[model samples]
Target: MINFPDDIFSEPADVDPDTLANLGPLTRLAGVWEGRKGVDLNPKADGPEQRDYLERIEMQPIDPQANGPQLFYGLHYHVHIVASDEDTTFHDQVGYWLWEPATGLIMQTLAIPRGQVALASGRASPDGSGLLVRADRGGPGYGICSTDFLEWAFRTDSYELDLRFNADGGWSYVSTTMLQVRGRDEPFRHVDKNTLTKVAEPRPNPSARIAAGKATLAQAHGFTTIGGGAGKGD
Candidate 1:
């Protein structure tokens, strides 16, 4: 297993919105959003099952993070999803959406409460509508890991997700996950798709807004910028 050194990280700072300009393709996705009429398709013993669900997501910009010379701008996100019929949760996820301005690297780290974790990576242009990212089972840098039960029953070979922004400022994603089921000789392609529309605008990063508000009040009272930036980060 790979281990991260504690010395690698510096003091955490409050998130800054001005740094969002460097996020490239991930910049637009930083904010609160909702997707209605999400449809998911999965492999069932009998056949394919389809279900409609609703999702509420909040993606907030974080301040720039650095690993020595490597820098990343990203969003910290939380997603809660519910289905029309079932009282239990349809899906729940927490992850980070990171963008490397220097290398055009995009990374998504996802963790579900159901003992599953995966990391997906890909590249995208700033103005491009379609973005594709990939992650595999045994990669050193970009890979997926699972618990013993999932690894034994449904081994995930690779995952690919494509996202496109429509004309109306909405976004849609098509996710394909290749799984090796224990009983099936052939690989099963599990697919899911959904189009999310903007239900509300995103709020400014917490620290940025708070600092800005304080500055505004101070300015009204005949004050000036402190010695320098607050240096707060997400």
Candidate 2:
């Protein structure tokens, strides 16, 4: 359990502005990536159904964040997947991957358009080659939540994601989700796995750019000063 400090409102001093330097095991994940030959398995009325897919993911560092005394370095990420045979989106997700350098704590917060969201947590060394995180059905922390209709039809019981950094500068991951489908006595295991290759490097975080003197304060805040007028990110 985490010990609470008496001065809960006090923020940490000397927080680093360079988010990439503090991301630890998640540093390698900051970039645009593409993966073909991905696989997914899901429950169907008759049985399980399997399909191949293509995926693209973008993970860019965000400015360091703090909540009172607690500090976090994180990445904002988006995932897009499509079936190999079609162009329509098969899956889409957006989330944040956060790490606490002081505690070696790793966390993943994800949301799907299908009205489900989850927070998963784990721990790993800064130089670890592999990582794992998990979330359960219901809890105050590290748990899952779903909409009413989803809860009645396809209840998600748990989720697990295992990651491995390859020797060739690539990465692979396997995600498994346990589901309790309506009118079914047995639970089902929905699984997806893929190996991704980097397609592009990530740009520096806003704070990092400011610290390096590469951007003005207004620009770092996602504003463009056009003849004294301002425009924010679109």
Candidate 3:
């Protein structure tokens, strides 16, 4: 028995355009970041194997999104990783990090090229130093999904990610995925961790850019008179 809102299609009347200003906990993640020291541990047929890798991540602001009365400010992100000794790509991922200021809710939606997608949710303070989100195999809201091959060979049971903001403006994350591999008696915890340094700042969202452009044009045309200032002639 679930309740439904009759006005589900009605959007909010007053929506803010500045995503960066409204991002709350996700504000620190906006920028281009690079990490040279990344570690990955995964279960192999014989046993667990460790690998050192390099990682780059880019997070940029997106315009405010609305679902009825619900609004979200988010960052669209892409992550690329490569093994230290290899030239080929070790892993690639794309995701969105969303925050709802009204509810103190944070969500991460991730998609990997290997045919897996997940949505994880958590709660955080506006200025929290750390955050954690998790998703399970058979949850109603936040859950994990995978392709047929992955389901048959290495089934994922749960996913968890913990993020920490350092004092020096850098950030680090530890991600663990519980996998139930075929022929294995127990679940394996595949983990990855890295610390990233900001390389470039994020750009304004489209709505903010438009508003700034309008303000610039108004200033150039000496429209200050409209706000009680005298015109150039008087």
Off by over 4 Å in 1: 1-17, 125-127, 210-234
lDDT tens per residue, model 2, 3-55:
87888788899888999888988999999999998999999889999999999
| Clash list (residue pairs), candidate 3 | none
Show model 3 residue runs off by greater than 4 Å: 1-6, 125-127, 214-234
- Predicted model with the maximum lDDT: 2
RMSD (Å) of each candidate, 1 decimal = 7.2, 2.1, 7.7
* Cα lDDT, model 3, residue 102: 72
Q: What global local distance difference test value does model 3 have? A: 0.89
What is the alpha-carbon lDDT of model 2 when measured against the actual structure? 0.91
Candidate 1: residue pairs that collide: 13-232, 13-233, 14-232, 14-233, 14-234, 15-233, 15-234
What does the lDDT read for residue 18 in candidate 1?
A: 49
TM-score each candidate.
0.80, 0.94, 0.88
Higher-scoring candidate on lDDT, 1 or 3: 3
